[model samples]
Target: MSTPAAPALDSLDLALLQALADHPRVGDLELSRLLSVARATVQGRLRRLGEAGVIRGWSPELSAAAAGFDVAAFVSLEIAQGALDTVRDELLAIPGVVEAFVTTGTSDVLCRIAAASHAGLQGVLLDLNRSTSVVRSTSVMVLSTLIEPRLLPLLATTAAGREARAPAYR
Candidate 1:
């Protein structure tokens, strides 16, 4: 069953979310202690947050280097008009193609792909070119990644803004 939808997040909700993200392995009991809330409150918020799609249940993180697919690259492709879905389907069929996006600018779509080596990447690129709708592609190899995915800082800023707006209660 789904929890009733929340129009927007309150500061307390953000606090609970931040606390959970900071300690992913912690249970509701521990969360309550960490956030200074009742255990039941933590449980309720988690349930609501999950149902609201605020928390997509945890997924295991994978490293391409550890998996032996070290080569990483982003490819921009120009596709025939009205054929994005078809080309996307073809790109998804390639095992090396990890993710894709439709974006603005010179190219119609962009994709992130990985390979075991330079030769493997060449094979993947050739496969990408075989799509009937894809007319051209430009690939850029990733030298290194400096920043990884993150969200805590944004949550903190939003939560602080909400707190500042709250009036002193009677």
Candidate 2:
């Protein structure tokens, strides 16, 4: 069973998250040393955070280009009414369609997909269209990424909020 969700993260919780973000390769022992806390403390904190779903397992970030799937696009899909589930299942069967979401717009579903080339993308689109559930689709290819994914700054801000409420003695 999943553990109960955690409430607002405390200062220490934020500190550990920040430390891990800065030094992803560091072990718990090194983390405790850097933070000047007991090793078991670090271990326990990580365990609790993980069990509470605050800490998701770390997975290496791989570049789509490095994997030879260079072309990336956000494809908005207009799904046939009453076929959302069928279209979603169809999308899942296609490896090129990486992420999909139900959206509020002209389209019913939005997808982020990668292909080796424009021709490959066309094949992906064609494959998607094979499912009659997918009525139509519009794709916007990514020109470039100005900012990579990051959440540390926002986490820091959350920690600051907790700090503001901390007891003076703490």
For model 1, residues 1-170, the per-residue Cα lDDT tens digits are: 66666436666688887776677878889999988989998888888878878787877668987899999999999999999889978987999999899999999899998999999999999999998899899999999888887765776676677778889893
Instruction: Give stretches of model 1 more than 4 Å off.
Output: 1-7
lDDT of 2 by residue, 28-75 (tens): 999998899999999999998888777788887678988999999899
Backbone clashes, each candidate: 0, 0
For every model shown, what is its TM-score relative to the native structure? 0.85, 0.87
